[model samples]
Target: MRKIIMLLCLLLFLTAAYSYPQSIQAYTAPLTADEQHVLEQSLSIHEIDREIARIESQQNETERSISELSEQLEGKNEQIKDIREQAGARLRAYYMGEREDLLAALLSVGSLRDFISVLDYYELIMDRDRTVLNNYKTEYADLKKTKTKLESVSAELTQIKTNLQLQRNRVAALQEQVDTTLGHSTDPEKLMAMIEELTKYWENIGLYEVRRYFRALSTAMSDFSDFLDDHKDSLVSEKGGYRLEVREEDINAFLRDKNERLQDVSFEFGQDKIIVHGSREGLRLEVEGHYTVENEPENSITFHVDRLFINGFELPDTTRKELEEDFDLGFYPKKIVPFVEATEVDIAQGTLTVKLKLSF
Candidate 1:
C-alpha cells in the first residue's frame, strides 16, 4: 500500500502540468477515395460492374430530373406569356382611346363624391397593370434560371452516358483479354468463382480495418485518461458515479499528437457506438462499433463491430462477426486504476462520456 501510494504520487508529480487538448482542429482526408484505390490496385470484373451500376443509377435519376424540369419550364413560359399579354392589353387600351374617355368621365362628375369614385376606379386599373407587369418580371427571371440549370443537368446526363459507354468498352476489352490468355478454355463457372473469391478476400480486409480502428480508440482513451488524472476535480459527480465528458475533436488532437500518419483520421461518438472514418494513401475506410467497458479484474474498454464500410460498400455480416471475434483492442487506463474505475461509457452525437466509481 505504501509503495502504491508512492507510485501514484510520483505519477501525479510528473503529470501535474500536462494539458489536455482544448481547441478543436480538423485534419483533411486524402483526395482519392478508397474505391478508386481498389480499382487501381486490382481492375477486376466486380469493380467494373460496380462502377457501371453506379453510373447507370445516376443516369436514371438525371433523366427523371430532366423530365420534371421540362414540364416546369413549359409552364413558366406559358405563365410569363399570359402575364405579358395582359399587361400589354391594358397599356394598349389606354394608348388607343381609353385615356380620353377616362378624362371625359372624370370631368363630367356631378359632385366631389362622384369625382373621388372615378379617381379610385382609375387608380385600380393602374394598380392591376402594375401588378401584372411585376408578376411577368418575376416569372420571366425564374424561367431563365431554370433554363440554365436544365442545360447543366442535360450536360451531366450526357457525361454519365459517355462514361457508361466507356465502361462497356472496358468490359469487352477485359473479357477479350481473358479469353485470349486462357484460349477460351477457362470455365465460365471458374471465372465467376474467382470474382466471388476476390470479394470475400476484400471482406476479410474489413476485419483488419476493424482491428486497426479499435487499436486507435484504445490509444486515444489511454492518452485522455492520463489527462483526466491531472484534472480529476473537473469530473462531474452523479448519484453513484463520476463522469468525464469529451468531444471527438479533443480525441482527434490526442491522436494527431501521437502519430502524424493519423492526420486524416476522425471519430464520431454516437449513442452506444462510435464512427471512425478517414482517407489515407488513396484509400478510405469507415467502421462503427458499440463499445462496452470491463471491470471484472481490470478496467478496460472493448467493442463489437456493428458496421464496416470500405469505399462506401458495407462489409457482409459474416465479415463483421469475424471482426468482432478476432482481436483484442481493449484499452486499459492503468494509471487511473489507483483512483477510479470506468463503469459506464455513453456516447451522444460528437461527445463521449465515461462514468466512473472510486476504487476502494
Candidate 2:
C-alpha cells in the first residue's frame, strides 16, 4: 500500500509538470547581405524624413519672424518719411523768409520789456525745432540698423533652407535606388526580416514610441501579406513574420500619414503635472495637464489629456471638444497583448514608463 501511494504521488507530480505551458522564446533570424542593405537604407530614409520635418519647421518659424520684422521696418520707414517731410517744410519756411511777421513784430516793439519777451520766444521756438530734428535723426539711424540686422538674419535662413532642400533631394535619390533594388526581389520572408531588423535598430536609438513603432510594423506586415498573396509559392514561413519590401514611396507615404496625425509628441512627468510637447501641422503644441491611464474593455489603455495647447494658445471649450472627437486616446496593444496579461502606463520624473504582466 505504501509503494502504491508513492507511485501515485509521482504520477501526480509528472502530470502537473506536463500540464504547465512551456516558455516560448522570441526568435530572430539571420539577415542576408541584401536584407541588411535594405534595412540600412530604410533606416536612412526614415532619419532623413525626420530631419526634413525639423528643418521645415525651423524654416517656417524663421520666415514668420522675418515677416514680423519686415512689418516693423515698414512702419519705421513711414515714420521717418513723415519726420523728413516736417523737417523739409520747416527748412523751406526759414529759407524763404516766411518768418517776416516775427521780424516785423520784433522791430515794432517800442518798450524794452516787449522786445525782450519777443526775443526770448523766438529763441525757444528755434531750440524746440532743433531738438525735434535731432530726435528724428537718432530714430532714423536706429531703424536702419535694425533693418540691416533683420535682413542678415533672413538671408541666413534662406541659405539654410537651400542646404536642407539639397540634402533632402540627395537622400531621396539614394532611397529610390534602394527601392529599385528591392522591387526586383520576390521573397516575402527576406522583406519581413528586414522589417524586424529595422525595428530593432530603431529600438536601439531609444527615441520612438513603442506603440507607434508597432503600428508601423503592422502596416509593413499587412502590405507584405498582400504581396505574399500575389506570389504565394515564394512565401517562406518565418518565426515572427515575413518582411515586405519597403520602398521610398512607402516611406514617403508613412511620413505623410505621421505628419497628418500629430507626430513627435512626448510626455514628461513632474511633481503634480505632466508636460507634453511636439509639433503638429508645422506648429508647436504643448500641454500641461494631469495625466491618468485607465484600462478599458477589450485590452485597451486610454491616456487622458485634461488640457491642451497649440502654439502656446489654449483651446476654447468648443475646439477642445473637436480635438477630443478627432484624436484617439485608446492605444491597442496588438503584439504585446499576446504575451502580457495586463498593461499599465505611468509617468514619473520626466519619463513615461510601461509596466506589463507576463502571462507565464
**Best of the candidates, lDDT:** 1
Candidate 2 error regions (>4 Å): 1-30, 93-116, 184-189, 196-205, 208-360
Writing each residue's lDDT as its tens digit, candidate 1 over 1-360 gives 999999999887435312111000011123234323332223345456666887899999999999999999999988888888987887798889887798789889999999999999988977887898788888988999999999999999999999899877777776566555444434545444433443544434433444565566555555655655555554687776577676777767767766565678887787778887876533467878876888766686666778776655554444555455555544554465456777778789888777777776
Writing each residue's lDDT as its tens digit, candidate 2 over 171-236 gives 788677677766866885667565554444343321223233324433443333243244443323
- Each model's lDDT: 0.65, 0.55
Best by TM-score: 1
Q: What RMSD does each model have against the real structure?
A: 20.7, 25.5
**lDDT over C-alpha atoms for residue 254 of model 1:** 66
Q: What is the lDDT of residue 215 in candidate 1?
A: 62
Model 1 residue 332 CA deviation (Å) reads 33
